[model samples]
Target: MSHVSVSADQAGQRVDNFLLARFRGLPRSRVYRLLRRGEVRVNGGRIGPEHRLQAGDRVRLPPVDLPPPRPPQQAPTRQLDELGACILYEDERLLVLDKPAGLACHGGSGIRYGAIEALRQLRPNQPFLELVHRLDRDTSGCLLIAKRRSTLRALHEQLRTGAVKKRYLALLTGQFAGRRQRVDAPLARYERGGERLVRVDAAGKPAATVFHARERYPQATLVEAELLSGRTHQIRVHAAHLGCPLAGDAKYGDPQAEARLGDIGLRRLFLHAAELEIAPLDGVGARHFSAPLPSALESVLIRLRQQTLTPSPP
Candidate 1:
């Protein structure tokens, strides 16, 4: 028999999901088999797979044969140093970094190493580092890391209650008129050809975004997109629905728009996470963080202004 106690970071997760994470190599069906056979119990009583765990709860499991855990792989020193160079802020409980474009937040699905993996390698002694939220692999900006389970729980609550403000900068394919526009639409996620895709649908979860025009050029417009609700691909899908898809977004953007900016060096999705603000949950003042756009993205704008025949909008 084995016993475990749920900590703050482990709270609110389903029993089966928690077990799956705890025993990394365990198959999903095997986890449920344990639950069905009463081989797993919480507080000395049988619990269903969907039971939500709470902090400090005790979990008991029956002994079963399992394979030995794999040895940890050491991340390349160069990758670790590169990630360290992007650090924007760090403290006892948080680690914030200016994540570069084309780097996944965490490793899986054939990727050898990602931001979190490299960070782990850099701080091999630190035990509790975990991502507070996630960003797309191609999106660059202020990524948050929580060093303490309590801090992670607090930040997760902030995200749930709309107390966290996330702002992103994007270049739309064509002129986006008006000062700002709110896209109040629902979105649904579906898998096609092993790729995840999100689309606006009435039956899906509620998703909203507010787009504010920051600057306008003849061919494309630079806009600030404020997410009212964070759904999968919310900004990208909403932008496409408005007919102003993000430049270089091959998944949701127009191909012609991408070609139009190809000469200007628009090689990836023209989206950047510019800022993050979280209202203090424990009587402290709000915390704000910002990341500057990468040089490559900035060069695209410079080239656009110089080559495009149309002048900047007044």
Candidate 2:
């Protein structure tokens, strides 16, 4: 039997997930089997896989077969250089980066390495680093990394209580009628044809989004979106529900609109994480950060301006 005590860095995570991380080569099914068989115990009692671990809790594990350890994949030098350049800010307790689009926050599902992996390689001396939250792979913007366990916990609390504010910029097809609009809809995740998708459903979790029109083009409109309740694909689904799906959003977007926008240089999902605001975990005053739109997206806007004469609503 092996005994381990959960630390602040490991707290607040599901027991099963913790086990999977600890035993890298263990299959997920085998992990669940251990839980089902009561081979894994917490504080002298068997607990379900979904149980959230607490700091200093004792976990007991029974001996099990181990798989051959796979060699860690190293991040390429070019990728490391690119990630290093994307750094927006760094401090003792925080590391913020202007994450580029097409980069996943973490690696999995056949993806060899993502932003986190690259960072781990770039700063191997940093012993503790973890993602505070996740953005879609194609959503570029300010991403937060906590340098300390306490800082991570503090930020997670802020997220739970709705203290952290995240705003995004996106280009949507069709002209919006109002300067500002709000959508209150419930969102649910479902798998369709082996792909995950979110939709507005009455039985789903409550979600809300507020959108402010920023610019108007003949074929598309740029808008700023504030998330009231963070749900999977909340902004995208809400925007689509409003008859203004995100331009180039291959999943929930309009195909014809994307094709038209592609002719003007909108090649990727037209969503960017524009701003983030939150109080420091160290009880300091709030800090605000913003990431400007990438040049590719800007070029698309410039093209629209030159080709379309539509005037925006003042």
Candidate 3:
């Protein structure tokens, strides 16, 4: 049996809880099995799973035999160029990668080799890097990744509890008369060309989004969006319902406007995950992550600004 002495900081937490906290990869069932077999002892005595640990308590642990590591998978030919890659923040538990436009978070449908798979190849030793949340393939900005299972669980719990804050920057194709507006619409799935799509339906699950116009251009408006409920394409569907579909949103916007926007470098949907705020577990502190507007979106903004300066004929 291996012995472990509890430190001051680890005191007050339960033995099973503390063991689970320290050894992230170990399953809870295994930990409890060790406790029941007297393989785990506290202060030279076998204790129950509910034993509260105290500072200076010496615990004995059984030798846990782990499986042999498997051979690493060969990565694809495409090497991630770090020069253009934006890293917003990183800690022992998490990494916030500023995902570029046109990169999928995970492989699906007919696409392969996504951001997470590429990152795995980039950092082979970190086999546990996992996506805490996802952004659409065309969306760009702050995307959180967890480095450990425990951290992933913690972050996911925070997301479920509505403790994490998410904000997006979008350009809509029409002038919004109101400065701030809230859309409380329910969304239901609809079928289009054999593909599933979400639409605002009164009988569907409730979804809400808050929009505030930041700047008004001659033909477009810059808006900040805050999502109260996370649903697939919530912001895009809601904005479309408000008669101001996002710029370059081909699937849900006016076809003529989409074609016009396409001529000006607004190729894909103009939605981005701009900022995220999450409270850290273990009482570390609150953390915030933000990514600058991607070059594609920034270029569109520049063109829009130039258009605003040109005088319109009465």
Candidate 4:
């Protein structure tokens, strides 16, 4: 049995991550099991895995196996270097990155390591580095990382209250009705064929997104999506509700359209986190960030433009 007072530096961390970090070799499954069984307590009360610790909170840990520390995992040299080069902006308090597609924000779920793990390896001495928000694995663009616990807490508050503005660019199919449109539908999640998916439902949490058409192609329309409420797969699900599923979206996309895109150099989801805006914090003014579309997606656009302009075979 052991009791530890959460320090200011340790505050705001979820119990699961705290346990994983504290016990070097502890398997994540074991950590959750302990939490589920009420073996871990906060100030004499059981807490869930997602419970954030606060300064001065007393946490009790039950007797558990603590294995010898495993060797520190070293990420691939290429991953480390790629993360370093993708930095759009960095300060003592935060890091803004133009994260490429196919890279997850955190490591897990068949991915041995992701951007967060690689960054930690690259800056081994940096005491605190945590993801402020998550972008889907196949979604590319501005992903935020906090350098301090205080920053992480503040940013999380901003996100929860919808103060931070996040916008994404995606290519949608079908005839978009107007130059601007808003999808105000709640979404619910379910599993099908062992894959998680979301659909609009009346009994789900409230969600909304406003989209502006950037341009239109022969078979698709490029649009910018402004998220009013952050929900799992909100934009993609909402776009589908509008009958304009995202191009190259395997889950809710048109198979024929996706097949056409697969021929035009669009190998991944045609989505990007194009912009982000954070309000003033701790006396600092608001900050904004933008990332240009990747060259691969851009190349597809070029080909689409040429196809649109060229004389069609009669």
Q: In each prediction, how many residue pairs overlap at the backbone (N, C-alpha, C within less than 3 A)?
A: 0, 0, 0, 0
* Candidates 2 and 4 compared by lDDT, better number: 2
Best by TM-score: 2
Report the C-alpha lDDT of model 1 over 44-126, residue by residue, as the tens digit.
Answer: 99999989899999999788677788666667777778888999988888899899999999876777678887888888899
Per-residue CA lDDT of model 2 for 1-314, tens digit only, reads: 99999997688878998899888879899999999999999999999998889999999989987899867778889888989999998999999999999999988788887888889899999998889998999999999998887798789889889999999999989767679999999999999999999999999999999999988887678899998888998999999999999998989999999889888878899899989998766967899999999999999998988886765662
Give the poorly placed runs of model 1, Cα more than 4 Å off: 1-3, 7-17, 27-41, 44-51, 60-68, 281-283, 308-314
lDDT values for all models: 0.87, 0.90, 0.81, 0.89
TM-score of each: 0.89, 0.92, 0.73, 0.89
Q: lDDT at 51 for candidate 2?
A: 88
Q: lDDT: which is higher, 1 or 4?
A: 4
- Model 4, 225-276: lDDT tens digits are 9999999899999999999999889889899888888888889999999999
Candidate 2 Cα deviation (angstroms), residue 94: 0.8
Provide the lowest-lDDT 10-residue window in model 2.
305-314
| Poorest 10 consecutive residues by lDDT, candidate 4 | 305-314
Candidate 4 has an lDDT of: 0.89
Candidate 4 Cα errors over 4 Å, as ranges? 14-37, 48-52, 66-73, 310-314
TM-score of 1: 0.89
Error of 3 at 24 (Å): 21
- Cα distance off (Å), candidate 4, residue 113: 1.0
